[model samples]
Target: MRKRILGALFSYSVIGLITLGLIEGILQLVQLQSIRSIEIARKLYQLSSREEYLGRYCHSYIWKSNFIQAYGQHREDFLSSSGLHVPHKTRGWTTKPNVTVEVGEKQYTTNNRGHRSQKDYQEDERKYSVLIVGDSYTFGSDADDSYAWTNLLQQKDERLQVINLAVGGYGIDQMYVTLKEEIDSYNPDLVMVAYISDDVFRLKYDFRDYKKPTLQVKGGNLEIENTPIGGIEETHQEIKAELQKEDIAILKLDDLLFNLKISCRYPPYSLFSKVMGQMQLLAWEESAQFLAVYLASGAEVEEKSHESRGEEVFQRWAEENEIETLNTRPYFLQGSGYQGGHYQQAEATIVSDTVYDKIMDLESWKKFVETNR
Candidate 1:
């Protein structure tokens, strides 16, 4: 009887261990399937390659172009220092410059001359030179000088000599200051301030790097802050700290896998896209909020957003001042709302392609330039 009882206990123990193993196998299979569900055409990064991304993680630069890294900010795969992306060839007419153009303190090399590359553009004073001002879009990141909307605008109408005064990571106050300094040098015919919504909160983040005159509103009038440049150093230090955090990749396997799928997967919009957007909104609240706040401040603070931060300040100023600005939010939609400030990732970007192209269209660019001029 004793022998039989001992044998029964051993048998039960073996079955329990087998059950646990089976459970673990089932869970791993479910996770694998969950990952496999992504279906989309993979895209390649236009500038950097995957091997470059792996190298970048180990602390190395990927592309030779300065604009490539600047544009890659915010969105990981869309603009990451990492090179895990489908190659996107630069559009024709947007080739590397055979010449260089200087804006602010930075110099950009451009292939402005087809086969004939000029050394530099010394503002031909006689021509009606119109400089288009904004942020990265105006500068044309991850793209050549010609690919910039300003360049595309120039191609549409030969009458306009459009110079892009857009810089990556610049806010409205900075832009306004840049304009104040540059206008004297370039003497643009007209300034079409494409004030992005994201420019609003930059003061709170990189307030130190902000050297422009502080702007204030008193009874519907705009006032420059006139704050000393001495105040900006502290803000620059904070910004540097934030920039340093980019190197830390302390994320979970599932989190990393999901992002990898989204980064590699093009056309994030699909039957399952809404679900993905929901997840992203949950994960990226800080980014979204920052965009909302800065975009509002980018415009003249005299105005207020009806919960729409940027529109209240800048849009109102544009309408009242006739800045020839184009706000693409009405024709566009993204979860909470669609305005130029929010960063579109994965499927949201794919979904917004039409709106983006419409804004980027030769005809549309021509219209914006013509109106602003």
Candidate 2:
């Protein structure tokens, strides 16, 4: 009787294993994978009464680390002693000069002083110069250096020289500071401040990894915070420490499958989500300052209107200072062919054409260039 019972137990165990394998196979065939399972589990967990335990383990840092390790890159390669960018005393970071960064099969080289252009500029050059300041769009983050709007404009009119002092992830405050610092040296006949609506939202975050400074309005003045953050290594270490106590080890199989499927996967809209999250975090402080500045100017501050408010304030300041500015807000509103986020070749062409039109329309700009040249 004991022998028979032991044999029966072994048979039942084998049957259970086979059934489990069949269910997993069925799940795979039906396009329901581990990620879907996890999503469903998360929803069920949320519906439960055990709030504290769920909250503690829900957003595991280990999971985020594993996700990045699977889908993201080690930023150390792009930033370190041998990296593209170097620490700047005033700008927080700037690209290393005369370095050729290979992206895919193509290569992009920076000119002397680290600007992303083939031609180098001298203060004494006998050319009609236009100084451009803004963010990634102006820096040609998407299109090639040859295809960048600034480059297109240069191609269209060889007589006009364009100096782009734009950097990726720059806010309006940084543009203002860059123009103030570089305009005298470059001696550009016309200055263009190119901006997108997102620049207004960027004013809120310190963006520690980039070591970017932020602005806060105090006593009706824009105060610049030039301090750098701890850096990316410190952030990684902090995250690792937070997840050390949890049993959140990544499996080899998961990592392999993630890499296999990564090409088809869409990157998360983390930046937009981050902006929204940070907006909630900074609403009170920014709103108070926004209210004070607007009220002082005899302008009414409508509730939930600070995004446009921030932009309008800067626009007014630029106008008052007699600065030439080009706003790309309307173009973005109309939409472009760019995938993910940055502008494509066609969009860059549009920008180049629009800017050319604006400059030609400005009689003072035309006079300055013609007279100076």
Candidate 3:
């Protein structure tokens, strides 16, 4: 009886191993095919063969090879070569101060304060200062310095001094941190926090292109983690070592077959809500009127039902919190359209018009103008 039991156990173990091996082999073959397809696409479209560009193609794949090839390589080249963004101790990365870079026909210039502007910010008591914080959309990714909506909005009203503190690839968490750190110094009468649906998902990544600070919910409050983020190479080494500790064969198989979308343990919206609350508190403490601006991407603009879950939750939360919100989707739809997933010149003009109108219509702005007059 004992011999039979041991034999059966050995046979079952062998069967399980064989099954796993077969799955692993299949996954390897599928990944190879996927890579071939990606290469064809790259060649056909003249897509960049840069590691970062290829990494975007690998994002949907779960093979270990895909992850290994792309990990920490996605934005490293751009960050190093562009000289626009540099490592930050607290925020993980920030825009390099007073640098100018031209891409295609568009020129990006950063002021000494590290904000995207042609000129440095000088405190003008006569003007109502507006501080804007957000990701690439608010940063005006593809738009030239003169054509960005912030600059356009400023051109509309002489009484307004608009200062954009937005950085590309920033999550709402980073925006909050920036607002807290810079608000008192700028002493803006109005603060605008602009975000797209994708920015909320970015909250889940502690490491995207390079290391970044992540946020967590603790006892109904927000806690920041992964602070003083390491350099690209350091972060790469840590991730590699950690992955190496796991059973590579099983990990690859599980990732490929099971499709475990285990990016973050916490739901993104929970942290998002906490960050938004904290931002509101900070703005109030600084005596600034806070506004949340929602900008829709081309996908959301085209498909009405495809509005992001993050945006829905945010709208509800804002209403409940009595936080004023602006949806810029209508303005975008009314304009020419988005270009390369960003606002084109005409759409930017629409944004500027909408925001200027919103500000003028604000009771706070009215009171401020009245008081100043």
Candidate 4:
């Protein structure tokens, strides 16, 4: 009886190994076939043979090497030595407070609150303050502090106190977090959420340039992920762990089965819409008027266009939510307003003028300005 039991166990073990081997073989075969198909498609359709298009699976070592090459420095050095940007427990990274850094002809100066301003925020009861939150365009990247649209807007009117809380490289998720965390302190009369279409697509990644908070839609509500975001070393370890778990054959199979696109997956619009809704709700809770400003990118300005799928979705979402929106594309298209993939001084002027006009057109803004003045 003992001998018979041992024989049965041995047979089962052998069968299990054989099944696994067969599965691996099938996966490899499928991968090979997929690569051949990609090659044929590239030749026939004139598609570029990019690594993403070819579905070249990067192993753990290769991925790490690629990351190092992309950054051009050790992770620690990159994170610690990144000028003006210090790691934040919640927002990922924010500008160092009361610090100024000069790069070429551009000067980046942060006030006491870490915003891109020269003056510390002092709430004035007599003035109607407009709080601006968004990414680099709103933060005025590649432009001087005085040339930023936020500053220009402030200069346009003395009754308006424009407070810019924008940070470079922030996604809508981070912007929402910033607004939630900072709005009550300012308690401004109006809150303007400005963004470009690319900012929406940034929702698809947990890390861009560095670690960041990501959001998801759960049961019609937005849920924050990666809370108390890890430090540089921790983030690096997490990324390494993720890469180590990669199953090349399985990854290849997934790429082939899904015919995955070259870029990161399209931005999750449901999540995006939910986040915007939450922002609107937050503003309502604080009794502050909320406005969405869609800034144009260099490409959009060059094309003289305003409509992208992301922008269209956002417009529809705003309409459904009864949220007011201002699109700056038309204003940007009126002249050569872009440079180096960001808004030049001319574009900043255009944005300020357009936004000022939009604010003047709003009844709530008019009433707020009147009451405060």
Candidate 5:
């Protein structure tokens, strides 16, 4: 009886193994295994730091999704070769003055002051000027220089001398510093500060590919650190030098948790959100005719379900300070076909028109111009 039971158990185990092999074979035949393997690899890729996540994660997944990409992104050539930006001592980086580069199919040209304007800025004849500051969205990422919302705003009225002081990948602290440095020289009748969601959390990081200045609040007072960490290559070398001497146990439990995707929605980030709000408010207090505007992209809504924590903070502070604020969420994907990413020419037009309408109709923006002009 013991021998018979042992034989039966062995037969059942063999059958189960055969069944599992058959299922795996079916999956392989359907190409599901390959697809799932790619998906799993992409997820693992996303678990890396943001720099690696952005610069690396999208390659395979994007290529798979957009089969149109025979090779990776063609625009990489323009991005790498474009000597359109120069390192700055205090502000981190700024657009190079008087540069004309062909990005993809479009020609992007900067004025003598390094702004991507259709024509040079005429300071003497300016009647009403708007100084717009922020990161790539404000810098008109992926859009032609002539079509960028700032330039479009200038086209809205001949008198509106709009200056675009936005650089790609700038954080809130950098924006504040840029505004402080340029506000007096630009002397605009109205100042528009544009920010996307990441600008808030970016305040916490000292390095992003290139080293940058960052800010922290201690005992309710703001403090700055890591200013002018050198240019891109220099910063890369500096980080490499530090990493070379790094301890083996640097990846703590908290670092592991941070690596998880859920950490972005964790409560601690909420505290950073509040701090970011306060930082923007402080910056606003420094400018005379400043209006905070949140640029919403279709990609943000598709990727994250919640409204940006930074936007919430900004709206609350704007209410308390009675500062003019605009959320461009509605403008996104409305007849623009802006699926995600930097705006195309049509989307840029819509955004510029929407902002122009807000300036004309919104009481806060109008009041600021009237009072400050």
Candidate 6:
């Protein structure tokens, strides 16, 4: 009897170990398949930082970059690069003018596809004839740096060399200063400002927010403030200012349990989101607004309004100074083909399900910029 019991225990132990091993193996396999199934950039990201381009990040079978702003995204998801709005990198507007060369410590390289490229960072080119500046949209959030507006701008005018000095998360204030400092060095024919609506206005809230009017006519000379971002007086204190709008709707633990019980009884969008995610064949162009708007959080909806307001001021400033200002939003918003929609690693939106149209039209914007700018 004792021998039989001992034998039984040994058999059980062996089976358990095998079971655990199999589970781990299966998990790893699933992870691998998931990585493979999802599209990734074909290149490897370099180590050094490029001051003017989108940073990149990569892993085996997986790659990511912040070059494309996933519309209506929060500070969630995998961060493979120094993404916009993170506030950790770039030292945020406090650095000195002209002397502030990009350091190697924190820059990454990202391609157009949400994939991180593979390459070591190195200062390749410096001498450029024309420099363009703006926010993520101007910075080419969804596409590779080469596909960005500035890159397109470069192709259009062969005689005029171009530099995309647009950084992510920057408002007009940074644009004003960065241009003033770099303009003399590059010294070109035109100062083209590829202003993104979302980036032009200086919200009384954000730190880098400051707007300069297009024209201040003093004795008939168009006077541009173009001040270094520091001199402006701040109105609303950021840290203490209470949020007036948007209900975040945080749930308590008990409420979560009750909701979970209901979810088990019924079903939720989680399953639908998964199914839609699996079927890559969905035509984003057919139903761009439906998907994106449905998933849009209230805060995101509000941002659209902000972008419009900011664009007005920025355009005025650019025009009065004889600086060329271009708006690329409408072109991207009205895309008609597949190339116009479907972006990856976008800022995870509340309206993630139906945002294919916006993704497809990115090229149209780039193309227009290339031709016009």
State TM-scores per candidate.
0.38, 0.56, 0.80, 0.80, 0.69, 0.34
Clashing pairs in model 3, backbone N/Cα/C closer than 3 A: none
- What is candidate 4's lDDT per residue for 1-373, written digit by digit as tens? 9999999999999999898667545545544435557655444222222344434422223334454445445444434443878778888877788888886888878888888887887788778788889988888888888888888898898888888999888889999989889988887778899998878877765666567788887776677887787766676677666655652434334443333443436676777888888888888788888999998785777685435765777778877877789988777677763564777688889899999988888766789767765
Q: For residues 1-373, could you state the per-residue lDDT of candidate 3 as single tens digits? A: 9999999999999999999888666544544435546655334222322222334432212233333566555733435656788877777678888899998888989988988888788999789889999888878888898888888888898899889999887888789878878888888888899898877776766666556777888787677888877665675576577556753443446553222334323355666788888988888887888888888786777665676766786787787788778888766665444553777677778778888888988777988889997
10 residues in a row with least lDDT, candidate 1: 84-93
Candidate 5 lDDT over residue span 1-373, tens digit each:
9999999999999999898666545433433335446765445434433333435322212222222222134432212457777667676667887888886887788898888786787684336667778888888877887778788887888656788889887877788777767766765656777888767656655544245676656676656667755754564455555544542233332222334433443224444444445535544565445567888765653444556666676666666665668877765634535577877777777778888887787554566567666
Query: lDDT of each model, Cα atoms only?
Result: 0.38, 0.53, 0.73, 0.74, 0.63, 0.33
* RMSD to truth, every model: 17.7, 14.6, 6.1, 5.5, 10.5, 22.1
Candidate of highest TM-score: 4
Tens digits of per-residue lDDT for model 1, 1-373: 9999999999999998898666544434434434435432011121122332334231111221222334335323222221211121111012233545454543445433211112244566444455444565445544443344445555554454556555554555555555554455554444445545545544322222122334444664444464443322343353345445542333223233433533453221121122222222322332210011112222222223335444545444444432224454433333343233323232123223432343354343455557766
Deviation (Å) of 136 in candidate 6: 1.3
Report the CA-based lDDT of candidate 3 relative to the real structure: 0.73
Tell me which residue pairs clash in candidate 4: none
How many pairs in model 4 have backbone atoms within 3 A of each other, for residues 3 or more apart or on separate chains, i.e. clashes?
0
Q: Give per-residue lDDT, candidate 1, residue 165.
A: 53
Candidate 1 Cα outliers beyond 4 Å, as residue runs? 1-119, 205-307, 318-324, 330-373
Q: Candidate 4 — which residues are off by over 4 angstroms?
A: 1-50, 54-72, 75-82, 247-264, 305-307, 337-340
* Model 5 RMSD, rounded to 1 decimal: 10.5
Task: Give the per-residue lDDT digits (tens) of candidate 2, residues 31-138.
Answer: 323444576544433332122233432322223355335333643422452356665545555667777776665455577867767777656446667777767777
Query: Candidate 2 — what's its lDDT?
Result: 0.53
